[model samples]
Target: MTLNCLAVDDEPLALGLVCAFIEKTPFLKLTGRFSSAVEALQGLHTQQVDVLFLDIQMPDLTGLELARVLEKSGAQGQGPRIIFTTAFNHFALEGFRVDALDYLLKPFNYEEFLRSATKALTYFELIHKAETPMVQQAPQTQPIREDYLFLKVEYQLIRVAYSDILYIEGLKDYVKVHLLNESKPLLSLTSLKALEEKLPAERFMRVHRSFIVNLEKIGAIARNNIQIGSAHVPIGDQYKDVFSDYVSRWT
Candidate 1:
């Protein structure tokens, strides 16, 4: 599947380079090229844009501000994914906060550009797969079971077994999946609520607004806290009654 791209940069040279990169990429098509964010906003209204290569610093409207506008107006909740191309490295964190697919430092080579473009390709491919309808229906007697899920981390999708996930922590727009044996948790650009919907209800429970724990992985429970391995997760007051009811059945 080909992704329609838009290149927006105030610098003539920078804009030319990004447009050339988009032209050379096999799966990306350059739909529009604009010198400023305001011009790009107008272009967005005219055509469908799947990915945006934006420069953060502009005279009238900054790339970051434009991203917010798209989030609210375009493509429901899933707006066009952005790949911020800028000279400054400090805006990297802000770019990620806006859910950019990737950030390309200015003066980057074709190889670097391709790497970022490839990430956008992977992201769109995943979205396409998710949106596709199933061919056949399952029998009433037999239900489909999913043992693992693909979590998007940076550019690649990491396959994580449900059994391996100890718990999930929500941090604004991102979620951290704590695994059984892994020392470091896997960070993905998705909310805990979104992940909760994808997880098996029988095996996972929301013990807190910001935390979801694997029911089978819970090691111990005391007061308003749960122990899962070496980590201690707090149980929010709102979820206390439900958790108590679940524990009462086992007791």
Candidate 2:
């Protein structure tokens, strides 16, 4: 998988070096190079960047600040994954806090740069694999069994079975997958709309804009809410008709 990369550094020399490294890597494509985090943030909107090579100590909006901005920006939630490059090693902890793929100490060589780039490549490859829906053809005499999906939680991809899921709650750019027999829901960095496409329609249904419940896990429906064990998920007006139609069948 080719990862479109953006390089951002206040120093022209540093920016050039990172861009050069990106170009040399066969799987990495240099999408844009910026002298400051401000320009890089602006470029992010116009470009299709999968990874970012950023310098931490730039003037105005610093790399760390920019990373925070990107984190909170709902529009940029699924933005480029970061790889911090700086002369100082002090910001390593902060970089990882922002979920940076790698931290490269400055005066680094191509070998060091390549390692970081490769790490980003591996991450994106896993992301692509997880996003892809699995299609299987079963024999006419057999039944199609439900399978599991990978959820990107922080830096790790967690495997979750469809049968174990009781419901899903959308939280902006993230989703909380409530599982059977599990006390806490598995939080994943993904949109509800993206996840809906991967789920089987007959087994899962959206009762609200922010909620998708496992149809089989519904314990009872009372008024405008559906009960799934202890959780009472509200049924949105927009989805009431479809949910009501499904309810009518059993009635």
Candidate 3:
């Protein structure tokens, strides 16, 4: 997969080097190279970038701060994968927290840059293959079974099984993916609307504005709520009819 890439750095020489490296890489398409983060943000608005080669320290907005802004901007799972390029070693840990794929220490060579770029390439390929829609065959054929979905959590792509899911909670631009196999919920930058599109309609249903539940995980149904484990998920008035129709078919 050819990744549309952008380079953002305060230093002119540094930005030029990144651009040159991108040009030499067969699979990376350089969209733009900017000396200021402000201009890069504008470029981001116009372009569909997949990977970002960014410098950490800058005036007005640091790379870390820009990443936070992008995350909050409601780009959801559509945001570019960031690969931080900094001279300091201290920012390495902070990079991963903001969902950075990798960081290149300054005064680095092409070998180091290629390694990071390859990592981004691998991730994009896996996600694309998984999300690709399967073509329908015959009318009488059985439905395709969905086993799992790859969720972009922080910098990593986590494999979440349909059987392991309890419920999903929406947090504005983010979503909490609760699983039966794990104690901690997987946090992702995506809208409930976007997530609803990714999930299979037969096995998963939106019960409320802020929640989607795994049908198999429902322990009981309360008056206006569905009980799964200890959580009581409310049924939204807008979605009650659809939920009722689905339940009536099974009952």
Candidate 4:
């Protein structure tokens, strides 16, 4: 699938680099390009865009600041997939906190850009697929709630809101749920496999030998490791598919 995209940067060289990157990618369509985030924002209001190429340092509005405002003021909750191009690594975690697609440091090579773009496309594909509920032949559309899951805790069928689930742990046989509000994990006698079946594959994912994490709660992910709150989770060799699937789903 070719993704439509827009770009915003102040420097001519930077703008050229972004446009060139888009040109090299067969699956990316350069719908719009701008030297100002303000102008780009106006274009996005009318244009149907999938991805956004943003530069962090601008004259009046920083890329991060512009993205924050766009997220708050744009079409409901729909916002473009943002890839932040910056020279600083400090902003990487902050970018992810707002669900950024990828972090590309300045003076990025073509191979680096290609890899990031490829990963972004893969992420988008998986997310869109998972969020899509299987269509029943019944001529009626079933509304799929994208923000909640039901976990079986013992004999009790516990309903956990998506926002409340802190993170998931993979035990030898069972998975543990750490709630954002609760003092300790609301231990479930459910295996990770069983729990995963009930949960939305698009948002919740396995990351470690003992962890299946809520992507929303993730602070940052580097290599095969994820940082959720103060705890660090590993991505198991066997479960790398989980990370790949989750990333591909949305980026």
Per model, how many backbone clashes are there? 0, 0, 0, 9
Tens-place lDDT per residue, model 1, 93-175, is 88877778889998899999999888888877876664442223243455457688889786456779999999999999899
Q: Which candidate do you rate higher for TM-score, 2 or 3?
A: 3
- Kindly report which residue stretches of model 2 are placed more than 4 angstroms away from their true locations once superposed: 134-251
Off by over 4 Å in 1: 74-76, 133-145, 148-159, 171-174, 189-191
Better of 1 and 2 by lDDT: 1
Comparing 1 and 3 on TM-score, the stronger one: 1
Which one is best on TM-score? Answer: 1
Candidate 4 matches the true fold with a TM-score of 0.57
Per-residue error for 165 in candidate 3, Å, reads 1.3
Clashing pairs in 2: none
TM-score of 1: 0.86
TM-score for predicted model 3 compared with the true structure: 0.64
Local accuracy of candidate 2 as per-residue lDDT tens digits, 72-129: 8853458888888899998987876676777899999999998888777777777666
User: How well does candidate 2 match the true structure in TM-score terms?
Assistant: 0.58
Tens digits of per-residue lDDT, candidate 3, 104-199, equal: 999889999998899899898887766554544234367566688888777667788889999999999789999896789999877889999989
Instruction: Predict model 4's lDDT versus the native.
Output: 0.77
lDDT of 4 by residue, 1-251 (tens): 88998888898998998998898899999999999888887888898888898988887778888778876776424768788888888987677655577788988999998887887687667556555564432355656455666553432235678789868887765568888968788766557777777778767876665777888898987787888888778878898885776667565
Q: Which wins on TM-score, candidate 1 or candidate 4?
A: 1
CA lDDT of each candidate? 0.88, 0.86, 0.88, 0.77
